[model samples]
Target chain A: MNKREELLTEKQIRRRTFIAFTFLFLFLGSAILGWQWLHRQPTDHGAIQPLRKVLDANEFIFSSLFSKKHFAKTYSKDLPLPHPRVNGKIGLNSAFDTATWKLHLVKAPGDTLLIGIDEIKALPKTEIIFDFKCIEGWSQVTHWGGVRFSDFVKKYGLDEQSKMMFAGLSTPDDEYYVGIDTKSMMHPQTILCYEMNGKPLPLNQGYPLRLIIPVKYGIKHLKRIGTISFSNYRPPDYWYERGYDYYSGL
Target chain B: MKKVIHKHPLAIRWLHWLNFPILTIMIWSGLLIYWANDVYRLGWGDRTVLKFFPGSFNKALNIPFRLAEGMSIHFVFMWLFAINGVIYFLYLVFSGEWKFIAPNRNSLKESWLVILHDLRIKRGLPPQKKYNAAQRIAYTAVIIMGLGMLLTGLAIYKPVQLNWLCAMFGGYEWARAEHFTITILLVLFFLIHIIQVIFAGWNNFRAMVTGFETENIDAKTETAMPTEPINTKSETDEQA
Candidate 1:
């Protein structure tokens, strides 16, 4: 009887040992797999269709909840943005032709009005320094001088109840574009920036006009403004469709 | 008479110890992320209540305002934390260790009795086994929570890449909040686990560290006991 008990115990012990070694092997195997996955450079620019689909669905669901009023309260203003970095050279190619530039306003379908840079200059110009956050984990403090979006709206009589959203200025070539919600457009810091860091807006920084909002990441501040539109329908955003949050607010 | 017996295996011992430092680093790095967005709290509008980390807590930790450093450390250490967790879980599953750790239908009732015994309200001592009902419940619950943390952590980390996971966890922000709360729960569990280990004393503790325990052989029980006796072959096989 004692011998039988001993044999059974021994069998159990052997099983445990086998299990332990198997687990160790599996651990090494998983680690190797993980390392391979991590080091593999992104081969497909738009590869992994299933993963992208999952990501898109997740973005839609997340944005819906994130834009909820209750959650927005957690988006605090305490964390300051760092020095803005240069990224995404879209439409700014040659020197900005300030002479030929016209800030086109599309109030309604087929109702487009063109305003020159001189006209924008006629509005009340304001300057302020604030951090410019980026979609990537970086930011920078920058000085911007331009007419406030609110001032521009008021001057053109565009701040009407019917106008629910605002679009930013970019080159005639639709390489770069930004769309902002109504609340962000009226923000005191939102500007049609004409100068940066005490000088006229650099050629690379959108010479004639650009949009700058302290409360948003730099993506929303479209450079080289060519056309501005106000609309009830959501405007086409350059980054939103690319998995970034539509309301890219700070 | 009570006799000393081994409870935790050597693999478990190493896994348990490894989790200590790895989880600590994870939590510390998570704190850095949380500090940047420390907006969560438990209270209604108007009257003030408890804050997450009062000024005193920050002062006590002396955590510097270094976001870059925080991010670097977090990204680097996350690999170790995640790998260790995955290995631990797989080990349990592959080794049939889940059988012992997982709670059964009788677990709830047994857990109440165990609790009552611990509180000194019950007359008789609890059943002697590798793990009591309370231990099983706590252990199983923590494992489940660990899985939860992983899910929520991934949801927040790659919200754009894994948007569906993010949505399932409520959202990116909610996942972050849930991850923080789970860390708090883990810390609480750690405290209780440590206290329990200490209360169990040297034999219990030594068994974990050394993978063996010295026990006085009861001659009568050895002869009369119906179960198989623990022998050298079983010990060696189990130890392996």
Candidate 2:
């Protein structure tokens, strides 16, 4: 009985020692695997869907929280706004007769109104001097004078509860389309700009009309606004399909 | 008729070893990034106590003045560092290993006693099975510091995008300063850890590497002992 007890005790001792060693090994191996896994390229598409969903949810919450901060600065008139060279013009390929040009406001079914540039000039004009930032990590300061987008929205009685989830801007031939977020479209800084540097916008700078929004990147500023539409569905964004965050706000 | 007993598991040994290279790479790449804006210092006015890096240090390191490459490498490796850290944390938490690493209520006082004993100012040592009180404190502190580094790094990286996080760290420049300070503390911790490892000598080092140690079992309870009887010298140990 004594010998048997001794043997059992020895076995238990060895097992305990073995368990300790096992734990050490588990931690060490896991740390190494973790290190390697982190360095590996992000190739799992199954993982990305969840991440994108989280990002979208977080963005909505964060944007709503930050929008209430009353933070705006006055820009000096003497500050020279750098004129960055135009990179690409997608929808402005075809020419349109100025006399025939009409800024269409799509309302109820068959209730669309054909408004001219002279009609836009008749509204209250607002001029802003602000910086225009590009995603390529460069910025330019420019003076834009135009009618406030909010003014038009209010003129047309577009309230916060409006069902329009999408805002679409297109060039004359509709070759290019840019989408604006409803929040940005209703922002006081967003304008249907017609003049640059105290003169009517040059032909190269979207002659008839363009978007001047301080809250967004330069890519969303669609030049030569031919038609503005309000829709329930998401409007197709020019840069979004090419892999960019949809809510590309400042 | 005696054999060594395994102490450290294979996993722990690998993780302990793997940390060396990953941490080294992170620090090296971080230095390269800091070279772009090395504005850290530890001095009151022009007293000249300590600058972040001496001119000689920069010369030896050969850090480039341009930020472009430094930024690229830093950004790329940051993902790896963060992912590894997150996984390590989750593993510890889920596997119940956090109990060992996390300090108990007595840890602070015991850590001071352990330090005194290690410094040879005190005779008796604290009761320790796996980690001494000092080790517990150091390890726990480093994890917390790692969290600080991650937070401060994010604050600096996306100041406008993560404006709230930036504000939490007391704004952009403060966050940068905090990040650099924490990094310096980590490097100091590494230096001290290596020194302690060397001080602990061959048996401790071998245990870490080979996952085995030669612990002695008394002749009277040789079979009852948890470890195998081996050639281990033990001086008289006083209770804490």
Candidate 3:
């Protein structure tokens, strides 16, 4: 208890009550109006424009502070998921043509490199066992084996293209696509995955090739990559257009 | 006859009231985020008594499939919540108001007595100050809970950038669980707090809103009650 209790007159108490409620209403009123205005704004992709704008700002701050020195923690390969769950099938068309599959690499539109699974396997292989996080809040400690995306970029002589603001990947049918920061793509753990649990990827798990990026949510791990392209501007993404953050960094 | 006494400072009242709505919105938005992975339940090994929520409950609240909106509101309002909490903490310390809010060693010894009084098993409450022993402990615990929420929120939000912090909270998944648990505890605290305020009656509630309480002339002896018990504790651990 406070030793100095300021005894007040009834008149003083009434005046304080008036001031208090007046301020309280004003504060609460503004909060309500602010939320209403936020929701009423036009949509940017799936989110309202204002919310998207902040997300953009948040991305800028997060990306600036993101460091390559800090790697995502790895677990023992023995502890990896025996059967990883598959999520999101927007671009995964149930169609024909695993035989004709060639990874189309586009550097500034005209410079194209057609790569086969053999070419990726020729390069050094990297395996990572990390908690593969999904934006939906579930995660799995799964093992992945692949050629590093950075190695693929280096081997293809796309050093200049790799330095661009973003890298966009799309499925063969081109229905589902993802745009990612070139910085994240350059992380040592970002891989052009061809193997999962020490075997060739299953058909449903992006069979021929997929992206295994440990630093981001699973949504950025575009599957069955038909084409890889570099961009100075943000590329179209499946989830970004459906109310997810364009960056979606972990 | 009734005499009025200043029970709360103007700054304290504003901070407390602001917290109610801000926190309510935070919890609401949090529910939307947790709806995606609501795995927690009050049960063990197939036995179950309660679920965080059922499908019907979520459907009624319109709380399902609003992850984007929930995330947007949560990220935006987190700054407000943190700022309000920090300001409240600083004011409590600098204004010497913590003396009334923070618990002493005696609080632990006396809190059970206050509880018995609350259950109406005891005939009378233990002599106390601006806050009873139970109140002092609860208020202090809540402030600590607020801090836990902020730290846990940061750990999960930027698990990559703040890898050290994420590890401190026992990695990302554990941090998420901690954040969710703290929210549940805060909601429980809110339920009890509201019920107690109702039990305390309008005269006591007005003290929060108006910063003044009108005391019955017959209870003037309480003027002495606030000092004697607390002065003894001051010599022990009141301010320690």
Stretches of candidate 3 exceeding 4 Å from the true structure: A1-12, B216-240
Better of 2 and 3 by TM-score: 3
Query: A181, model 1: CA deviation in Å?
Result: 26
With candidate 2 superimposed using the best TM-score fit, by how many Å does residue A203's alpha carbon deviate from the native? 26
**Which ten-residue region of model 3 chain B has the weakest summed lDDT?**
B230-239
Better of 1 and 2 by TM-score: 2
Arranged by DockQ, best first: 3, 2, 1
lDDT of 1 by residue, B174-195 (tens): 7778887898899999999998
Q: What is the C-alpha RMSD, rounded to one decimal, of candidate 3?
A: 6.2
Q: What is the C-alpha lDDT profile of model 2 across B1-240, one tens digit per residue?
A: 234555555555666665666666677767876775566677788776777788889888787662333444455456567776777677678766667778998899999999898898999986775678888889889989988988998766554456678679986567878888898899999999889989998668767766665555467666665584332221111111
The superposed Cα distance between candidate 1 and the true structure at residue A81, in angstroms, equals: 21
* Candidate 3: tens digits of C-alpha lDDT, residues B38-77: 8878888998778878888899999999987788778767
Per-candidate interface C-alpha RMSD? 10.1, 10.1, 5.0
Against the true structure, what is model 2's DockQ? 0.09
Candidate 2: stretches off by over 4 Å: A1-250, B1-6, B217-240
Q: For this target, which candidate reaches the highest TM-score against the unseen true structure?
A: 3
Residues forming the 10-long window of minimal summed lDDT in candidate 2 chain B: B231-240
Off by over 4 Å in 1: A1-250, B1-4, B125-128, B219-240
